[model samples]
Target: MRTHDWFSRKKDCDDKGDPEAVFNVLDSMLKDSLERLKNMRESIPLENVGFDSCTLEAVNSRHATLFGCLCSEGKWKTALWLRRKLIQKGAVLDVFAHNLLLNGLCKIRDMERPDCLIREMLEMGPPPNLVTYNTFIKAHCLKNNVDKALYLFSTMATDGIRPNRVTCNTLVHALCKKGLVDDAKKLLCETLSDDKEKTNSDLITSTILMDCYFRSGDTVQALGFWDQMLHKNIQIDLVAYNVLIHGLCLGQHINVAYGNFAEILKRGFIPDCFTFNTLISALCKEGKVEEACHIHDVMLKMGVAPDKISYKMIIQGLCFRGDLVKAIEFLNCLLEKSLMPEPLIWNLIIDGYGRCGDLGNALSVNNHMLSLGVAPNVFTFNALILAQIKGGNNVRAYSLKKEMLLNGLFPDLVTYNMLISAACISGHIAFALDLYDEMLRKGIEPDIITYTELIRGYCMRGNVKEAEKLSTKMRRSGSQIDHVPCKILIKKYCHLGEHDMAFHLYQNWLMREK
Candidate 1:
């Protein structure tokens, strides 16, 4: 923390009658290290650092704000160190600074320390301000300690500080999030009556109530509040409309969502990205691809440019319809908009074709993904590997698994599982065993499907002994021998006319289930 040269430079610049140069020198010195920053704060006279009111406030405000953020992030030690440095610098304690410290302590849930700070604020020096109380109230509310928040709110008036809109809104949001919509509504009504300005009519509180009601599956009360807002002539913003639209869409009231959308437009409030995206995504989910496409066209007609997500939603819809060609066309439009293709979109297209039994088109889409310069990640390879295996080309699937490793991507457990199942299917029981060992060596734990595949392979080859051994191993591995595999074994025993063994297996499995 030696500052010999920096102090000399500061004095030299100050003597040269360039105050700005002196400030610059101090700034550079303090920026070097937090320790140095603390040292400078203590050693340098504020008057020498161009001690105009603004400059002094700026320096103190920066320190307090930075420490507050650190506290919020739970960096308790750093925040404490900064506070100690400020105290050592003989900095005057202001309400804002105290609030910052209290805010941080509250964020870390340091219950005792916050009470101590509150005591210090009230008894020692600078008293707690409205911001101070609000911070504590917000912290308590966030932790679902609404009773404590309510206590603080009640105490605010005794201290001659009226709760503002922010305080009320914080409580309202917290109550709604906790699904206490009735309490939130009651609070909002009380706040509106007390304010007399009706300032809470901007639809934010109503939106929260509406969302809470929708989430609780009380759509009747949600719509009633909407009507109440309309009757009261509360100005509806696009955000309010979006909330209503999204809620209706989620409730599967598609026609109602559409009506809200049309009403929004009729009121001359143009639909934003959220409005269009919600309708499009909901319609797509309901297998109404044509209607989603029509909405996209409407967006274009209204000069509301669709974003990357909007296009992705439509592409997903088209893929669901097995219209890969149209999906790719929409993808190209997305690229034209300067949005880079994501692996998720590519995987969706691959899976869509794969599920349709169109392996050729799926591979073509994968190659197109490469041409677009987006390297296939694990998900990409996973989808393609599954597709290749489903097409009865286990050899190609195996090669792709190797290529995945060569491209610096480790094959995941799914890749190994698919390979094992593929080998078992082709009657290469020994190879499947070797693959299972390799998976174990790589720390890939076998799931029920892996054991079932091997067990099925053994039973198919009439090696019931090895099949039972693997089943025992699978059960020991903490997974139950699933019904399908158990049924296979019982049938094999019955075919061999071993009715006693078949009954034993069924009884044991039923006992374990119970």
Candidate 2:
């Protein structure tokens, strides 16, 4: 509804005897007004924008609920305004209302206001409770301010509010993320020791430590944690199994990881996309594309739908094996499934065909990609350019460079290097020099490949003096003078019967090596 219509409807709300109904209308009106004001980019006070004396008077007793409604909807600014208005009228907000406001503020990382509110709660009647401390602790942990979170944790005990599993879990996850796994372990141990039911280390905490150890490459320690969970009779969940599978895969324990996958199915725990993708990625990396494809087929047969990752991994596996025919089949399958493949997926096939010297299929894929509305990116153009260069079609390669510019994509270092190399090979020394000047203008630094290409181009034109000067410039620019350009110059010097100059060049290279 329009903002003005809300104001008009607010007038009819008083005739409704239900105070709850009147407050609901007021909440809806305020929400719509806030949205309108946001879209208009207006900075007017929310009170003036929506609420007025009549509306406030009508819902005076329902201030706390209204405040909660606003905060819950993430309209914190409007909520804060209503809160201040309520406070100005001497309304006593209870601990629940205060906690709601604290939650809202903490979610937005508005630390300053929450600090003041916590102080007010401490000094006033409704002291902060466990929920209040947890909210602040969680907020600090999310910001990676573990020190502050710990301080709040210590104060919780002084306030006679014990830190529960949620509090400890937050800190534990934060510590693990910061790579302070040892500290995390110590904290978990201390918290568990303090618990009267010392055996109550839940699956979440155990899985977190296991995942941490796995990521840190301490497979032994990670497995120890897993064994500990099993010993404690903890009901292992799907997330914990996925972590083990991923960690095992990372550690190259693919056999054991697959063993666990089988165990997951045997235990009636259905594997999800992550489970299949992890195995597929591992098998593909190990050059077991067939095994990975088998896993993909098994996923389909089991009625577990493969996601984008599933399709990408399988297609990438096929492409890496140079199985372009199977890769295209999978691509068509992806299209039939109505899953729009990303540009990376298309680039993989294009690059695969390019590597096999099949420029025809590569260009066909590029055209098909464009028709499907997936605009070619830099990598897309690079693959095609490299293919053109490899096929000895320098003109087509340079044309692709121009196409890249028209598509709003700047030619990157690889693009320039390939084009420069191709120009030198085709004896287009002047054109190669022009490309070098363009590189300098575009601020693309010339690396070893670039300088080598340009030096070779000058040597091809028999401009040995210019080639020598470029060699000096290349060294000054910090590109290591590789043997390719040096040998080129030496050959040119010998061809001109300048044996003395060639010997001098060799002597200087030897001296620089020293």
**Distance (Å) between predicted and true CA of 255, model 1?**
1.2
Local accuracy of candidate 2 as per-residue lDDT tens digits, 433-474: 889899889999889889888888888788999999999988
* Poorly placed runs, candidate 2 (over 4 Å): 1-73, 123-125, 194-200, 459-468, 480-514
Q: For candidate 2, list the clashing residue pairs, or say none.
A: none
In model 1, which range of ten residues has the least summed lDDT?
A: 1-10
Task: Report the lDDT tens digits of candidate 1 across residue range 1-514.
Answer: 2344455566444433655766787787777887876777777655566677887678778877887788778887777677667666666556787788787788777667787778777786578888998899898887889998988888888888877777888898899888888788788777555555464544677787888888788888989878988998888888888989988988899998999898997999989888999999899999999999999999999989999889888998898788988898888888888898788899889988877767898899899889989898887887888888889888998899899988999988888888888898889999899999998999988888888888888988889989999899888879755698898899999988999999999999999889
Q: Estimate each model's TM-score.
A: 0.72, 0.79
Top-scoring candidate (lDDT): 2
TM-score of 1: 0.72
Model 2 TM-score, 2 decimals: 0.79
What local lDDT does model 1 show for residue 179?
86
Model 1 residue 189 CA deviation in Å: 5.5
Each prediction's whole-model lDDT (CA): 0.83, 0.86
